[model samples]
Target chain A: MPTKINIRIVTGVILLTVQVLMVIYARFDEARYFCWAPHDSQNEYAIFATVNDQTLTPDQIQKRYRIKQKGIDPRAIQHIKDIIERYETTYGKDSPAEVIMHYSTNGIEKPSWRWPKT
Target chain B: MSVNPLKIVNNEMEPQLLLTAKAVVLGLICGKYFFKLSDHFLPVWPIFDYLGPPHVFEAVLKVLFIFGCAGILFNCRVRLCCIILGLVFLITPLSSMVSYRNAKVFTGFLLFMIGLHKKGEVPWLVQAQVIILYLGAGINKLFEPDWQTGQYFEHWMHNIIKNPYYINATMLLPPMMLSKIMCWLTIAVEFIFPITLWRRFHVSFFLWTGVLFHGMALILSGDDFGVFSIAVLCSYFSFVKWPELIRVSFNGDNLLHRIAKGIVNVFGFDNHFVWQEQAGGPLVATINSQTHTGTLAFKKMVLYLPIFYLAVAVLISLAPTAALKSKCALLLYVLIFPLPEVIGYLKRKREKA
Candidate 1:
């Protein structure tokens, strides 16, 4: 007979197994069902790229940069550079990613100042 | 030469010590990823939809694997398990690149609890959780005057329950009384929860009161805090002899068994109750069955999924937090004896009443 400790061991195993299976299932489920958006026939992974120059906000800038790293858009590289240049003016040349992250998260309205025309 | 080999051997094979370590790692992994998954999947905040479906799915899988590993470690020898578990857990926060520092702090808290363990100590880990949460809650409330005054949280809860967008059928409860009871109880519970840990009251009384308080919250707030509270309650009984749950489960089964058997037969629900004709009408059926299924329907379900599924999600969300809190609270109560403790004084009033 397994001890109480043994039961906990079993519980742990069950929890981990369930989590792993759920992840696998959820991944397949998303890919199968909700991957596509109405805007595109192909599933467009979310990212912020070149926003037509005239339209720029810190929020969009930050969000685009995030998606850029996830391999969403290569074009976002220049825009990210532009945003970094603006941010570094006040935040210093070596303003870390943490500052950018913090600003993006806490600031209710991203610096864009206007709504994006979808 | 007097050799200390025996002492060294004794030090090495400490079973309880190993369990303490296991509990800490298990608790950390469970806390970190479970909450992370919830945040991604059924996010409390609507705005942060950044994780997207694929990343959310990945997170869920990570949580499952972490939980699986903890279970595997449980059956193994304690010392070896602890070493491996501890290392994995310590590395986890780093691996996850947790942006929210609360997750890291929560992990540290569990590790601290593990470090403080003495041989045959009451499961301090569980108790410490409650105390930390109570204090955290108290501090949070202190920051928000409306919560302390029973305005903001009460109004928020009232609106949430009264939301017509969610529950159209209202006869399940008397809304006015339920609302009042919920508001009053929440305020009272938050206020007195700290005092419940004081030594004056019998531990059983505190436990029972807590169970009732959370039970009310479960029913009233759609099982908001119920899950966590239940988990916390379980930690108290860790010292119970083996297979205690099985014994307790079957203990009063003669009457329950008969009633359950009778109900099962009467309802003809041996398998799941499959409706021949849509149980509620086409519209109802559409809402309950067709339009909403799986996580895609989770948002719709959250807004409206009868009562059971809503309760299940609420319970699931609260489960880990509650258990974590209870263990934490108990740990602190024993370790730190409050000076000029008013908690003892508060206990006598309840007993006399």
Candidate 2:
């Protein structure tokens, strides 16, 4: 018969083996779980808004309205565009969010900040 | 002679040690209720949107999650209740978010795992997971050009923060100098955090440094990071040796003993429960009363640490400095935790002398 310590040891082994296996499986089965090997600080999206040279206060530009997109998704442009328009209409159309932000830690990499021509 | 950490054992205090860990999780979860209620950070996720469980049912799931976690904390079919809690988390919209997934999903899994090990000490797996989190964070930070150079950190502090006292403090030096120092320190501490596993004292030291870093950072700069900091700090509760925990419960003069006595009174049990030891014999707690004269097998699980921890969480919850005070409480234990080892070493020296 297994003693209490033995039972605990077995349980720990089983759980650990299964979790490690899950991480391995995540490599192949993307849907089962997300990436196991975390992306080191690769893609960063900094939140910034400005009028020419003067940066806008974080209060004026709602931090909640800030968009953090993952990877090379083109839809990121649209999201940022929406936030800018929302900020303009609500706060001031004349004081549009001018600066392009480039801060991201959502485990996505290699994205550029490009301004959409108005 | 070097101490072997694995040789340390006190099977009798296993449950309460784990229960204390549960109390931290429960407290953090309860603290999170306000944020969730106000719908502060719930972003619409594309994954949960299409995979369904729709955003509308969040309130119902929150209620279910609270009760489920409460049931688990109370130790009623803990594993089953934890699974119910996990399912709620898995289906929640925010669960798909990277931050939420990293925090809640991993933590829920840990709770379920620890529940399974209730009869034993906190499992080796939970300890490894914490090591992995720090190592992962450190490794992740290492490659970041901004973390290496401190440029991003400076920009973040100077631009992102609104009205934090620490911002002024950081200005005592060149903006880049402080950021650069902090950036590197974070990486170094996290990378080496896993080494604490080799010894008990090392674990406390490592955890204390982490608490100080997080606690001081939060207190000086109100950076909406209290949740993550407290959740991680609670992980250290698992590493607390069972013998020390039992000693705290038995020593009638200490706060833990008084708390234990208070708990006994609440259950209508005699508050005179005392731990008695004899030469070359097992330790035992004697329960002597008018009608009942009994010796508890010192069997740990049939005992508990929930009430003690809940009482602490409640005290912190009521305090105006909940964040800072609770952080101090955790930080205070860092010094307190090493007393047993310090005392033991001195006793051995005295005998040798």
Candidate 3:
């Protein structure tokens, strides 16, 4: 085996080489941004509302309902449906167009929305 | 202070546990869940866009990844096993996205580097990786005004903050100013993570801080991140300096050093070897009269234990008819935790040779 120092130099060179490759890949090709930063969802997507057809203001919905544009699964759609139903039962017949879930795709600002699946 | 990462030698037994923990993660996640053809994916590389892991090949690659992780868990031809997985990732198109997370990529590189670092000492590259990750995260947080104001973590415990007086065992702070304080404290610690690499800093304090941070993350974060907190905590194993089981020097004995010596004596192997717990535990030390009074824990004569355990695990995995691959997993610790006697035997053999 090489001396630990020599081994470390080799490891350093390898790390440097891979980092170079990563930079090139990110710069030219489509690589995931290696920022190592956590996403701030709240500030980026500032819209928060409940919708039956027309968007309801924050007070009508009981729970905290923030409109996001991704992670559109069945459960979220159901949550939207439940919220809309709750609003109508208590406040008596708001716009019944539909409840929807919206979030950013890839947890970044690319807007998308999905209607609730009944 | 610029400290030499190469001089930071780890005990011979430390990497074994780290590798084992990584293997446990692989066995649980890749072996259990990631094998599904529909879900399994190799992150998108433009060159390989058209060539995804084909129908049957996908299954083969997943199997290889599982076995490769098993091979590493046991320390069998780890370099080769890691290369095999690397090849699988290269050849297969099982990734759901065009790219994987930076953490995944960093760990892949780490797996390769450690596989090559067969001598049991943690590589300087690994040290650099850990330090850089913390620094990068800290610097990123520093740029965010909200983090400076300690906004995110404060609201992270929203339920308790809303209630006038509420307390749960899990919720340590009642969503008060303490949340902001803890948030800033965490960021400060992370920013100074590089200081741990310096010779002046006490490694144990930072390591314990890391343990506490991850422990809190595990308890408080709920299930959002899955096993990520545990995984990061396990990576801390690479940084620990194991307790020296054989002593080579005549430095003035401190009380704890004396106690460490007593503990080694109680465990036997006292006749031919001296012991000290400088920081890490169960490191092999080679002693010779002509050489410096005692050799430090850089000896790699006994690293094959994990390989042997891996073989045992492989044998067990194959035999159990309704095999849950993890059945043989816990036995890895059983094989590694004991045996200064075995290390002594290896030392004697090296001397004879």
Candidate 4:
């Protein structure tokens, strides 16, 4: 019984600690895992990708990111950026692909992002 | 028997509430996966590109999740089921970032907490986890300038949801003022919920309020939030004071009585209700020593029965209109309390004709 009680207590503490840490981490991070901050931002973004001098269509962009080419991302715009970065630096590394994303957060237009930065 | 509110409130360790909570949480999780089975089987994100057909791994996890849910639902190897479901949810996000919902991770942690405890033990940790979720969300929103200033709410209403009611309200009042009022009210509720939920006196009040709050959120946002509202609402069962046993006596073995018995036998897995036939007596249900007759007794039975409660929840979730969904409690009240009596009356009239 004592061992069982101890296990419960330890599990409780660890879970609580991780949740708190995630909440704190959300302040600095955009992905916001376990933070419970839903619909925090309305990131209206459009992603344009050019590969071998041919611009990728909306369907192609959606296929690449597994998200719509242009839509409102409820999380931070940074998440969309991260996805693009991860894809570009990974399987698409061999291909000469340039990506640019124009995004607005909370109805306020922000600076556009360009991959393979100038 | 007389009902003792104090006794019910004081007995915080009722195992039935925990069981019901498990049923609800797992039920919602299963519904989500079942509805979107295809999405889970596919590895949509670039992160899984190097994993060489990550779909195979995802398929295995999803299969395990379904199996775990079945085990939990059937009340067989529940602890193991919780652990498996928890691990599946925890690891699912690794395959694809799109799968990483806060509610899913929260559910994972909650299941893990439940699994760590012994059977029939008070899920104090589960309760605490819910409290922490509210506290974390409230604090996060409290500090967020956009949430505080109504910018986020305005963006959500004007651009995202484009709620006609909000637009109409803006005609009479300034958009910022109306938005700020709604935002601050939400912030206040979320911020105060943690404190209120801790107090025994305030638990019921906040629980109902939380339901309404989440219900409204679901209505306003539609399904954009997925099962987050359902998950949180189900977790509120952790704080509920469930009756240990219900004693019901019927006048005689009529059609209604037989149907009631059938329901009790099928849905009452825990044997919470004990039904007795009493010749030439009024139909009555005794719970916590409190006796209720007529529609009230029927309502009490339905409310206490886990399957019925879950059915009502599923029905409410499927209600067509936002208005109907938002007024879930009232709808439930009508359905359970008076609608059955109305149906019985119609049936009797038809039989007479």
Find the candidate with the highest DockQ and give its number: 4
In model 4 chain A, the worst 10-residue window by lDDT is A1-10
Question: What is the per-residue lDDT of model 1 for residues B1-353, given as tens digits with 9 covering 90 to 100?
Answer: 11211111123332333333333334444444444432232222333345456465456545554643454233333334333333333334332322212333333333333333433545444354444444444433343333334443334443433444223323355544443444455555654765666433565455556655554444434433312333343333322221101100111224533343344334321122222222222211123233422222222222221122222223344354444344344432332223223454577688999
What TM-score number comes out for model 4?
0.80
TM-score of chain B of 3: 0.55
- Which runs in model 3 stand beyond 4 Å of their true positions? A1-32, A38-101, A104-118, B1-33, B36-43, B52-57, B86-95, B98-103, B120-122, B159-176, B198-200, B243-353
Candidate 2 scores an fnat of 0.07
Q: After superposition, how far is residue B346 of candidate 2 from its true place, in Å?
A: 8.7
Which candidate should be chosen as best, given TM-score against the real structure?
4
Off by over 4 Å in 2: A1-118, B1-21, B34-60, B90-95, B98-102, B116-118, B156-175, B198-201, B223-226, B244-353
Per-residue alpha-carbon lDDT of candidate 4 for residues A1-118, written as tens digits (9 for 90 to 100): 4444575587678878877898888888766666777666788999999999999999998887677999888776766776787777765778857999999888888899999778
Ranked by DockQ, the better of candidates 1 and 2 is 2
**Model 4, residue pairs in steric clash:** B1-B289, B1-B290, B2-B289, B2-B290, B3-B290
Model 3 lDDT tens row, B31-58: 2334432323223333433454445546
Model 4 CA deviation exceeding 4 Å by range: A1-5, B1-53, B249-269, B276-297, B316-353
* B-chain TM-score, candidate 1: 0.41
lDDT of 2: 0.48
lDDT (Cα atoms) of all candidates against the true structure: 0.34, 0.48, 0.43, 0.69
lDDT of 3: 0.43
Candidate 3 structure quality by residue, lDDT tens digits, A35-117: 34433212222233445446655454332322232232211122333333444343334443344434432223444333333
* Winner by lDDT between candidate 4 and candidate 1: 4
Candidate 1 segments whose C-alpha is farther than 4 A from its true place: A1-118, B1-68, B71-74, B78-119, B158-184, B198-200, B221-233, B238-353
TM-score of the A-chain for all models? 0.27, 0.36, 0.29, 0.84
